[model samples]
Every structure is written in structure tokens, then in C-alpha cells.
Target: MGSFYVTTPIYYVNAEPHLGHAYTTIVGDALTRWHRLLGDDVTYLTGTDEHGLKIRQAADAAGTTPQEFCDRIAPAFQRAWERLDIANDDFIRTTEPRHHAAVRELLQRCYDAGDIELDTYSGKYCVACEEYYTDDELLDDGLCPIHKRPVDHFEEENYFFRLSRFQDRLLDWYAAHPGAIVPEFRANEALGLIRGGLRDFSVSRTSLDWGIPLPWDSDHVAYVWFDALTNYLSAVGFGDPAQDHTQRWPVDYHLIGKDIIRHHCVYWPAMLMSAGVELPKGWAVGGWLLVDGEKMAKSTGNVVNPLDLVDTVGVDGFRYYVLADTTYGSDGDFSYDGLVARYNADLANNLGNLMARVATVVAKKCDGVGPAPRADSPLADAAAAAVAGATTGWDAVSPSRALEATWGLIRATNAHLEANEPWKADPGAEVDAVMGDALEALRIIAVLTHPAVPGTAAQIWERLGMTGALDDQRIPDAVSWGGYPGGTDIVKGDPLFPRIAS
Candidate 1:
């Protein structure tokens, strides 16, 4: 058990929460929860990027100050996370004083290091992304490549970060830290960026009046690059690391969406190195959760409100589909049909049916009491295999694979009961033994799958008649076979997850 820190990119407040936002945050919460189960001291941080041109324009359109606009939009993220049951340790906003101080300190450090310098900037600019593009980089028809919208011609003097100087260093860093990026292929994509060539990026904006001012020159406000990325360090007390952030300096993993890979993988690491901060341990990149074969967009009229999905499938049901259906580093085509199909198969039928049958059998044959399992029960080896598989899958940060491994045990036990015809067995020693093994298996499954479906896990824990808090039980000891003692009252309840209509 060691300190494990994870973070989700501070979401942009230009828009409310959506499927993309929910997917990244949910993955972070699940991964952190698993680390906690291993007894690791964990810090999970998430927040909003409240300073940028998008927000400034959004505020103008809404007829309000930037701060007031942020106040209105920031709480929507917080409320959405609460509804989604995200367990973030800190929720930071770029507008906060701590963030302002951290951003200024970092800008000063880099400027002092000769990495940030004043330069004339003239290019096609995307206000939505706060990025400048060269003619070659823009779409052939003269539009922003990403937004696919026409970019405005702009010219201003701004401070720029010497990103060109970091290409060799970043390549060397990745070579030294081989697993710094997950899914291997994603790392290659980042490497391709470095090998292609690096360019100095603007770090301050003279035209934007809604950002933290440069410490050396108040007229030039920090740009999206400085203000947004600095939130990671500010949340962990960056400048005063020896005081409270020494051990937690380098985060274990940053769960990010693929759209912002350049910002997180290339630019963010270089910024940290320039500031003399330790680089993050790894980046777990996930692709966009596309809706109807297209990225969710208000412009496209295909934006899927994440909370609205909660109305269709319960929260845990929604979490399961996102993690289970989507491969972490690849684009996942999302649809209501796909979500409902996965919910019915994985959560409703496989897991929920197992819970219902086990409790129902126990109530009828064991007088509503959990029976004890012998050390060498029929399900012993299968239980051990499930435990091992789930452990390995989680260590690789694959929640879908982990849950599949845990459910393997449930399926095996369900099959065991079906073959033995435990209900037809004489209701004496035979029935008691069969029910005992199934109950014990359920206990193990609950503990293993808790990270993804916490509320449901807790429910199964209570039904299994385990004492004390479910999370208090340690893994190796808690999951070892034969923990279910006989004679404990078992209260059978409604099905854990009811089947959705087709």
C-alpha cells in the first residue's frame, strides 16, 4: 500500500457536463477507489477551468461578469459529480486565489529560466480552443482543424513557452519511463508529435482580460496554457511542496480524454519540467465517447446530457456501460440502444440474477440464514481464479476486464448450483453446503466489484450478512475462501437491478 494520486482534467466551463466529462471522471473515481481498497493513501482531484476566451465570450452573451458566469456554471459540474457519485478529494477552479498564485509563480519560474519570452504572434486563432494555427495546420478551406469552424485572423505580442527545446528531452523521458503512457499505442502518438517537430507555444494573451495577470507584467494575462494546466499543481500545493505535497508531487495517473492529448501529454509535461516539478507517473488516455458515430456537440445537435442517461439507466448501470462498452483509448460509439443492451446483459442478468437467486435459495432452505462453507468447497478454485483475474485487470487500469473477471466467479457459482440441483437435494447437509459456498462466493464478488458499482456493492455486502463496514475488510484476508460463517440471519430483498424493457 503506497500513496496513489489520480486526477481528471479540469473540465472547461464553456459548457455543462456531458457524456465525455462523465466518462473520464467516472474512470478516475473507480481507479482511486480500487487504490483505497489496497490501503493506499489516495488523493483524487477534479475541477473546472474557469478562465479562458470561451468563458469570457460565454459570460458576455449571458450578460454577466466572468466571475458570475463561472459561479453559475461551476456548480453545475459539482452537482453533476455528486449525482454521479464521483469521489474527488479536491475540486479546484482556475479563478481561485490559490490557483492564481500558483499560475503566477510558475509563469515567473519559467520566465526566469529563459523559457518564456515576448514574441509577435500572428495566426489563425480558434477562440473556442484558445489555440493558434498556421496556414498549413488549418483545414484546406481555411478553418480550424478541430472545431471545423472558420478561425479569425489575429495579431498580438505575447509570451511564449520554448516548447521547441523539449522535443529531445520528452523523447528521452518516455524512453526512460517506458510505461508513462498507457495502451502503448497512445504513447506512440505522443512520440510522433515530438518527432514531427516542436514549436514554441504562446503562454500569455494580451487581448484576453479575464485571466490571471503575469507577475512581471500585469497587462499581459496568463493564457489557457498557463492558467488551465497550473490547476493540477495548485490543487496539490505546488510551490510549497515540502510543506504538504512532497509525497504527492508526481501523480499516479491522469485520466484524460483523447481530444486533449496534446495539451496533457506534450504541453503539460513540458510545462511541469520547466517549472522544476516532478512529472506525473503516467497518463491513462481515453478516447471520445461519440454519440451516433459523431462527437457529442451542441452544434451537431447530438449532445447527450450525461444526467439524462441516469434517468434511463440507474447511475451504476450508466457507469457500467461506459466502462464496459468503451475500450479505454479508442473512440466508443455511444447510443441509447447500446447502453440499454449492456445494462441488461452485464448488470441486470449476470449480476442481479445471481444475487436474487442466491438470497432466494438461502431464505427457503437455510431459514433465512447464511450457511458456512467448508475449506474445500466446490467453488473454491473458481473463487481463487476470479480474485486473481480481477486483481491483474485492475492493476492494468482496465475496469471492464476487472468486472468481467469478478463476474466469472458469479457465473461459475450459478452454474455450480444449476448442475448440482441444490434445490432438489435433501434439505439437510447437501443443501446447506451448496448454499454456503454460493453465499461465500457472493461475499467475495461484492468486495471485488465495489469500485465500479459502490452502492450496489454495499447492498450485496449487507445481504451477505458481513459485519462492520464493507470497505474495512482487507483484500487477501477478506477474499480468501470459507469466510462465510453459518447461522447469520440473511434478509432477502428485491432484485439488485431490475431488467430494462427492450
Candidate 2:
């Protein structure tokens, strides 16, 4: 089987986890699960970016050492991931020794190749952004554009990566690998950045002591972006000569927020080219999760804890809202009312209602045993079409669209039941056939939606009396027509989704 590697940007450890962090992590988790469902060897990596001025400041304010502070905050992320059912293959923290070794090696290679140079630079810097802003780029109030916060003026002698030289090279690489960036428009944006000009970016800071010290020069520490970006390669054994890193070197996708597109698409790739590392295969850029039409910020108390959302709605319900309410690449405006509405409509009213109705009919009509769906069932063709839609939608990396396609089957099945009135029919072979088809339709749905709502899928699977692990069931055959054998003991469980009152 071919290998598929995917990574979410290692989160910064200045604060606890929030909805923004959970959003990207969940997308990565879902995609990785999808790959596994297709039987591809998959690796998913996510972790903390611990070495930065923000972390250092936060640590100082907490009256703890930076390492101690990172240790305390890092597990918050891990614990959140665990609670959210994230199944990452590995979690690589920047403070790990492996990460340090890899970052140093990468920096040294670029330095040796003459791409890194000592330069005296002065600019308006945003510690939160870890980026320099020119006069024109700054906001009208002379604040950093991204954070809308004050800027720190600094001048220093530091090492700069020759990013200016890679503009043409980046264009050439994108030319060779068209569609490497998703949402097509985002690719156009990257080209716009290249078509405009690239400036050399500093990769080392002399004043920072919390970061990894450059190998060639002990006095200067690697800048946060330089140090942080290497975690992608460091986790895959890029520094170790004995390890076979090539098997997973080129990742299938790098899922990141749109704010970091310049860093990942431009600066990171240029640094890799300077160090002779292969570039990433693709990037799936996501828009921000907005609260009140503003970006979620902990400083402003606008951040929403993902766990709190879990408490309000079940994990599957929350996941469904996030993945279904907004298109993958578009900004999603979050609201409690919207969440409840989508949950009640899709889960409680549509899929959940369908399951409850089917199981109840089977109990009274088929003696509580699932009947095999007839070959001539009308839904068989509808199921086939839904399956193809879901497969293709996910291939485009659009979870919302995939789920929409899967819900199409649910809507159709409910319509089929309404038209035939299976529950109203007399007990006989005809009623058995009707309820049997509905149960079979649910079996297909469980397989189709497992990636997005795994827990709910498991519940449906056990209620259906399927024996083996839902994951172990092969696709294309499991999801194909007529997988639910007749005469299996079917249990009519509680409502899969309880509606929240308006």
C-alpha cells in the first residue's frame, strides 16, 4: 500500500487549546481517517511550537522557566486532542531533542550553502506574529496589521535566509506542480506574492535566548519561524542518517490556516530548497473560525473552548456542525443558535429520526431481526450514487460537501419511507422488505460517515449487530449494495441524536 502523510501546523503553546486549534486538528484527523478507510498507509503529525517570544513572555509572567511553562501547557493540547478523539500518529514538540537536532541540521545546511548571511536589519516587528512590517504594510495607527497590536522597533545583526532569490524558483516549482495548492484561488494568491517580490527574511535572532542556538554560531538563536517550520521534517527523521525518511518525506497534505500561507508556501519551501529538502506535496488552507465577525483571540476573551462546545452538544454533534455548516476553505461564522439548528435538523431530525423509525418498524414487523435488503430495492441505486458523491467530495478535501452528499442519502431514505409508509404496512414479506431496505441504507451511511462522526457510527454499528470493528471493514465492498445480511439480531437503541429545543 502507498503511504499518505498529513500534518497540522504545530500549535503555539502560549495558551490553552481553543476552537481554532480544534478546527484544524479535527480536519486533519478526519482526512487521516479517510485515508486509512481507503487502506492507504497514513501518518498524521501535530504538536506544540514552544520556542518563541510569546511563550517566553507568558512563562516569565507565570513565574516559571520556559521549559516548565511549555511542559504545563503542552499537555493541555494533548489532553484536548484526546478528548476530541484526535488520532495523530505522532506529536512532536519543538523542545524535544529530536526537533532541536533536525532544526540545527537544516539551518547549518542553508548556512553552508551560502543562502544564509549575516545582515544588519531594522524594522517594526510584531512579537506575536514574529514578522517584520514595512511602513506601508502597517495599520494606520502604526500597529502590526495582523494582530492590530503595537509593534516593537528593533535593529540587530542576524542571519537572513535569501528568500529573495527563490521567487522564480517557487514559480517554476508551482508551474511543475499545478493544483498543488487547494481552493485554486489560494494558488493564485501565492502566485501574486511571487509575481510581486520577495524580500530576504531573517532566520536567526541575537537577542533571543529561549530558542535553539544556531550550530555555526552559538551567539545567535534560530528565529521562531525557522525553528518552528522544521518540526515537519524533524518528526520524520530528516536529521538521522540511518533512518529511512524518504518513505514519508513528501507529505500528502499540510493543513494550515490562511494566515500562515506566506510562511508555509513561500518562506518554508525556500528554506527547504536551500537545504536540499523536497517540498511538500500539497497545502489545504482553511479560513478562520470567526466569533462575532472577528478572529478568535484569547487576549480579547473571544476564544471559545472546544470542550465547552462538546459539553453543550455531543462530540458527534459538534463535529457535524463544524464540518457541515461551513465550506472547508471559507470563513465559518460560529453561533450557538446555528449549532443547535444544524444539529436538530441534520442529526436529530434527519439521520437519527430515520434510524429510530427503521429499528422500531423492524422490531414489530421482522421479529427484531434485520431482513436482507431486496436486490430490486429502489434505494440501492440511490445508495450507489451517494457513495460516489461522498468519495469524490472527500477527494476534493471538502468535508462539508462530502457530508452534504452523505446526507442526501438520508434525505432520500426518509422520503422513501414516507412514500411507502413502512411502519403503517401490515406484517408480512412486503413489510419485511421495506424495513430491511431502510436498515441496509443505515448500514451504508454508517460506513460513509465514519470519518466525520466515528463515535456515532460505532453506536449505529453495534445497534445493527455487526460483529467486527467498523474500521476493519473494507470499503467499496462494505459500502456496496447488500452488505447487511438478513436474520442478524437488531437492537433498537435510544435516539442517536436528541433534539435541542429552540
Candidate of highest lDDT: 2
* Candidate 2 per-residue C-alpha lDDT over 381-478 given as tens digits, one digit per residue, 9 for 90 to 100: 88998889888878878898889989999998999899988778888988888877888899999988898899988888889988898877766888
Residue 159 accuracy (lDDT) in model 2: 93
The positional error of residue 278 in candidate 2, measured at the CA in angstroms, is 1.1
List candidate 2 stretches off by more than 4 Å: none
lDDT of 1 by residue, 1-502 (tens): 8899899999989899999899999989888888888888989999999987888999999999999999999999999999998888999999998889889888988988889999998988988778988899989999888778999999999999999999989989989999889878888888898899999999988888999999999999999877888888888887554456666878889888777778889998998888887899999988898887888876778888899999878888988888778878888999898988988988888889888888888778778888898789989999999989888877877777887888899889889889877777667888888888888898888888888888888899998878888777778888899888777887678877889897
- TM-scores of the candidates in the order shown: 0.98, 0.99
Worst 10 residues of 1 by lDDT: 238-247
Clashes of each: 0, 0
Q: RMSD, model 2, all Cα superposed?
A: 1.0
RMSD of 1: 1.3
The local lDDT score (0 to 100) that residue 77 gets in candidate 2 is: 98
